[model samples]
Target chain A: MTIEALGQVNVTESPTAGSRSVDCFEKLEQIGEGTYGQVYMAKEIETGEVVALKKIRMDNEREGFPITAIREIKILKKLHHENVIKLKEIVTSDGPEKDEQGRPGKSSIHGNKYKGGIYMVFEYMDHDLTGLADRPGMRFTVPQIKCYMRQLLTGLHYCHVNQVLHRDIKGSNLLIDNEGNVKLADFGLARSFSNDQNANLTNRVITLWYRPPELLLGTTKYGPAVDMWSVGCIFAELLQGKPIFPGKDEPEQLNKIYELCGAPDEVNWPGVSKIPYYNKFKPTRQMKRRLREVFRHFDRHALELLEKMLTLDPAQRITAKDALDAEYFWTDPLPCDPKSLPKYESSHEFQTKKKRQQRQNEEMAKRQKMQHPRLPPIQQPGQHAQMRSGPNQTIHSQPQVAAGPTHHYGKPRGRGAPYGSNNMSGGGPRGSGSSGGGYGVGAPNYPQQGGPYGGSTAGRGSNMMGGNRNQQQYGWQQ
Target chain B: MAANFWTSSHYKHLLDQEDVDMVNPLDKEKGITLEDFKLIKMHMANYILKLAQQVKVRQRVVATAVTYMRRVYTKKSMTEYDPRLVAPTCLYLASKAEESTVQARLLVFYIKKLYADDKYRYEIKDILEMEMKVLEALNYYLVVYHPYRSLSPLLQDAGLNDLNMTQLTWGLVNDTYKMDLILVHPPHLIALACIYIASVLREKDTTAWFEELRVDMNVVKNISMEILDFYESNRMFTEERINAALQKLTLRP
Candidate 1:
């Protein structure tokens, strides 16, 4: 029956009882800014508990609620584990407080009546894995890396068992409290996957360096194996103190992966060639598996487990549960208890250091740009040499050029190219095709002649390139 | 925890019947009997289900919406918030939570078209305004585990995988949502109870399969009785009876 008529159902305005209002919380300071919004350190006046208040950016969000916020909230609500970051509660405040003290502020753009500013309250963490790792002269002990990995795997295992795929598992996303406990955070890209619901997930997830081969080849129907690949990358990065595959672009990313692990054939990954983007690019040459040689210091057991986790075929990759049960975790150099790890009196020390380094790099780039207004900012020494050897030849030979007389000498360090000589004259496709195949395929092959612009490489989805390897957002209460 | 019902928020936060009843101790003051309250809730569930179906959302969305409405009343009395407003709000939020994600404007359109009357018309703003209250009352615990997730597997394991048997068992599980069984029992046990009830209705002997499963049959029996009791008691209640009770309940507010 069509129960159609007209009667105004007057909903009684209940007195606000349990809304943790702005008056209840005293804002402390702005800690960090995430992709969605800025996070602030706040203290609950009643309980006096310090929390990271992540303001959900609703300014231009024409869509009712940001999908990432909704996904994170729904996932976090169901998850209750020690290693998983807790979402204490969602609280609403009067839109846009003027000061950090959160005093009775002026009317915001949404006006005084607008109470739609949603803030997610999270337990404050001190150090993120990225900040800790990026700390100058801060080298992680084998046991310390082990402890972090163990916690990461344990938290990841819990998420997987609950059918959630973290999708993003970089160092910065892993938060460490003062107790040295590491908890997985930033589930903005995460979602629950089920076999019955074969949803085609977006491939543009997980920062490029940590992205899996299956994802690089555009496999949309991936599972937890995608996350395992990232864990392997993090494990390797922790050990080596540098990203194993630091590709400049998508093709270069694939090339770097193939250079170290050897190119995947049909036998290795049954449908390797059938992936949507598979035929578009091919690793220049066959290379021997050299993870063992590259990580020469790692124990055999660790290498064995790493190999399994970094398997070219996602179908054959080790799961978080299997990786945890590996001999490496159980063997010599037992994982240090989280509490035993050394603590930094100032947790923000690393954050400040990272910011300073980034600032210096920016200043250096700006100074160099001013020196040669016509020249593109020189990224590599080799690029500078390429510029000098051009028509401006010999006429404007500057002091910097004289200091590095053999600037061409820098070509020997062409990354991922075992045989660097192939990038030069007379170095045919054969010349560099086997130094795990040289930069000739990626760089010089493009006839722009002056070498590909440095900015293009740096700007090519670097967030996707995510060499932010250092500036990972960490919300530390201290 | 979403996968493991024993450790899920559903188990930890869901209240028992007594506590749920305590939330609205003023029901008698509003001149509605406990039985009349049950009928009103049933009608509310039907209303949510109808709205959800019109939007072409999955069954899980409808179940979550109904559960949200029930949870809202477990803390606040019906007099505090009208069910007519809360029902649509729950459905709108559930659609987003379940990832079907219907537009608020579309929901308002369908809700007004279906439920609007001279005595009870709503605007899009009303639905949006009520949405926040529903979220607050739910305490933002949006994830809900349903028997259907576990029921399909149990049905297959019991060798009752035929379309007819599957549909019948699935229908039984949906009906169980009407009671507090979902809140009190693990989803697997609820699935088994529904399967048991479905088997009896079909006159199919699944005793051998049920024995294979090492579950507490006592719990299953209690669950079955709860569903049976609901059916027996509500058999005599009609739309007119529920409407009369709802008129009194809504009159005071």
Candidate 2:
């Protein structure tokens, strides 16, 4: 019997029948590839508003819908904050229509072509933090870094208070609009966790470089402290102009973290040896934490906060709320207004990576042309030329001007392909080549811009769960 | 939102008693009365429970799946969205949304094995297709705050640490799902109502504890009355009555 035979009657007039059709928005250039599918920059036909339409990939979904997409939509719907990316209404495309490129749609389920496509509409942002930082000759001033950090912490604090753990916190996921307003995006890895310590959350979350030491040692039970570790790494990256720990794999990742943060032991972390992989990956020798020594040039308050955030013990790691209250934020060169930060052309992680790949290809072609004088220069894809001439190209022509000796461009590090890449393995996404701190050198410092900052609006009087409750009962409580 | 019921979609979607009881015009045109609609939903909720048992998901998954099925019928008609197909599809979607994913192939395997009837037997494609429709009908708000999350905490606070009272109260919360109390009341309030019922049955005093919660007792009484009414009427829900209600929907030609 068919679905139609089983009472699949047309109820299009019903208020909940379907969302506004995807026809309302005209598809623009693809901005990024999300965990499921391509994220496109589209313009609304009615309002002329630019939006990021994240296509929910339906092909090969053995289960009905992707759990990651469901979690993202659910979390985004509940979250309403200035620093978090807003998910506009979800829209659907009609059956089997050819795309803008005149290619047949691949909307299918279990090898059977499905009728429509689902697109989660989100407010469009111009640049992600990685793309902005990766720009040649681009450097964030002290105040600018503070501004982004404050926003990041504010956003993260809101998520934590809401009981949502953004398991994936990295440079590419932090989207920055033209107004220099940073928003925490990509909630595919985010899940609502409870205070119950018995709940077994997967340890395989967060990108490799920014992954916390506890997670590297295979601790299944964790909390908001995990995200704080990544935030600390990001804070140090902004100050030093490179990633603090760029390890290649899990074992080396633990090694890099131990080398910087010192190896975890019962004395420092308390019950550290009880962690699942603690014995397997335990350090052979005790390593001294030289955070202050290595970051001697950093502001004293910044160093203090970093120490708390990068604490070997998950229990001791500073929370987003406490981090916001740190003396570093209150010190001189306070975070300026997000609007006052310099507005550059649109630069997403996807686009910049493509641009970097194009440049590498061009350099390779140039060297090959010198070797074989008679051969014509390699013709790159037409799309690459279009991408190269995009608005961000003007900034690309500048020479690699370093801000200091510490600002050398390290090679791009490897990281997990965005969350939800593996459905069955239940592990985190597999590692892919991510451009981390390689292009952070040669950033031109900006003047301390904008007026005295109005302090963060987050964590103030929002009636979040356990907002006023005692935290001593939770395992993550310090 | 999962922790706080106030800002959750579950809170936002809570309907009035009349709104929850209102039968869809399309279903009405198909000769399905208000009683028939309720019976049909109740029957499908049971169907979802059995399917969930076969799939071996948690009680939370079953609760979420049943809640999804009920929510679908609120905006959709049983005539257009068949309760037979919608019931299983909701379980499938809820399993994934709740992070206890059961494959579509497994669901299809169980459906064919459980139901010999052609109407109840759906292939994997049909369930997958209905999943999209269910997602659309839900407006993609899959996060459901169940009374289960609040029950234990309320029980502990009320000092009803006894095993029998806890189990009885938990069963009452489960029974609340068979009705539309989930659609009308906040989850915590529902938990409170269940505790109120259990205290009376076990002959315990929780009035002081309930008072300290600072919630309006009137709403709790209303929800408690609804639960009692469901128990009173469900005794008369015979197999023939369920079949009669199911027969009201116009079958495919």
Candidate 3:
């Protein structure tokens, strides 16, 4: 299902008094619903620009999107860019957004029982790359494929170069504008990379199919290569009809990676022997069927580029710049213009989907009149992490929420790594000034300038899950 | 922070340096002005850099902090509350959001040392209290997009190719902390600008490579000039000069 998202919906309609009820949003209808929330096709009553509105019900004390939503608002406010989807604004019957100044500057029009839920405003978009490819009549010639790849690389180039790894680099994450431009959307899974990165990253980012091998083997310390690996998967999927390494689970995903990329030989890849979880698989393994063998009829240049990108050793895999610079891409057959590609009118289901949303929203609004029993106002701090099993148990030991840091709760580690520091540094509670005055002040030494920062060495620090003997390198894409 | 040219803070706040007004927070328009963001910028830098500094992560993490700060302030006004409070709050949130956790205590302590007063503010107890408020105000849009991730490869493409990661990498990281440059150009453009400028200073033959590339020359030049201007004003190198110019302002750090 597809929904629109964009920035700059127009001030004319949003602030109007019943020029149309909030219904100008047209709440056309829902296109899809997922684990966290449901998405709707909405239109601005003023300019009639369509947008996708994702509404997540904060039914429990544990829901984090409220926090995530606020954080996204904060960052998107400043992150103005062409390749990124603009978060125009956020609306909610959740009472007026709390003034940052505390009660000092509360607005008068806020909190009239009519408003209580939250609604995030984004630029309306047409379709995502994956969905575009799924269109019944949509077809890409070889040049068209190259064009999409170039755009993808260009967008990724903007992201990775900015030190952000869109952990989820699948086609679904890349949205295409009607103008033939591609914009990267959904920062819900993205993170900014700091030069002084130390605490091992968590294994929680990208979905399983798009996950890099290092992350699959539980290595928190990884970089843009992880995203590149996903892009490689997406590129391959663009060529093939289905997902590249459609592993139902983690182990299966790892196995599929080993099947390709020649299974981590000590020769092509060194240091593979050092990971704590580096399980010694059969040394005598078969080479991955090269792109040449699988495709059978792909242009040699395309095959060659794909092969290099999906290389087992991430260090050797072609980078976004290299892919763009590839002779195959720049050769006699240049990429096709994005505009020349045919676009399909949204299915009737798209329109019907809009009307259904209106009915459902009215039902929700009526139910909300009495204050939903399921979503009472969060008057106080709410309990988080119901997934907690007796403080500090193995996250993997439990079946779900396996991505939440791999630390043992309770007493901090003694001279070893801090407890549950898989995603953090001290394993102490968040460095927030929860009590009142800024607590982190004057504690850590100020960052000095000149050469590299002093804390750059923290990369090798002991992590909650740092000691895996086998650092699995699944090169499953392409 | 993938290359959206218009909505970014870069196009929003990068104004020509006019006389800065501490009392007037709305003065920061022009691509991205720093004075209006003095509270937010330094607070975010100290909070994020301190956290990342303590954690020993990459400048990538620090850069992420700046990105989050800009992200939060984009749709928000500094007046609803002090950006100082929002700064650390955003940093804490960004840390968690980025999956580079700096315990709440550590972040608070760092803020106490860097921003708050010792007699009334450093009570460790007080800063922790501010956390919830910070979360409430931001409405929790914690995820951020930054430029540090893109710089490395763009330099390679521009033919200014292959930066000395040790120096250039950190240099690019430092540039993010200079101002919210991440809000304007995409991360790689900033990286390219940084590398391109370094090449010019080093007297390297970068012309052949730069000329062969296909990009907006104005964007490259604009990014380079911003960095240069920031470099000239840095306290690390020219505090003596800047301090003389900034002696009139006696607001909180």
Among all windows of ten consecutive residues in candidate 3 chain A, which has the lowest summed lDDT? Answer: A405-414
DockQ of 2: 0.35
DockQ per model, Cα: 0.19, 0.35, 0.07
User: Which of the predicted structures, 1 or 3, would earn the higher DockQ when compared with the native?
Assistant: 1
**Which residue pairs overlap in candidate 2's backbone?**
A138-A443, A139-A443, A401-A442
Query: Any runs in candidate 1 off by more than 4 Å, and if so which?
Result: A1-17, A94-96, A99-116, A195-197, A283-290, A297-299, A345-350, A357-478, B1-12, B23-29, B118-120, B233-237, B249-253
lDDT of 3 at A309: 74
Taking the tens digit of each residue's C-alpha lDDT, what string does model 3 give over A160-252?
665666666666567776666677766654555654555466574566666767777666666777878887887766665445564544555
- Provide the TM-score, chain A, model 1: 0.71
lDDT of 2 by residue, A1-478 (tens): 1111111111112255567898999989877653356678999999999998888766635565767678788788767778999988999876665755989876554444344567889999898887777675576888999899999999999888778899778777788988879899888768878766567876756766778988888788899999999999888877775565655456766876776677788889999999989999977887877667667667889889999999989998899999999988888888898888878988776666566556644554564557642232233343222121122111123321211101001111112221111111111011111111122222122111110011111110011112211121122211
Looking at model 2, residue A358 earns an lDDT score of 62
Q: Which rank order by lDDT, best down to worst?
A: 2, 1, 3
Candidate 2 chain A: worst 10 consecutive residues by lDDT?
Answer: A403-412
Q: What is the TM-score (0 to 1) of candidate 1?
A: 0.78
Per-residue lDDT of A396 in model 1: 20
- Kindly list the per-residue Cα lDDT of model 1 for residues B43-145, writing each as its tens digit: 8888898888888899999988887887777667677678888888888888777777776677777877786564346656666667767777777667777
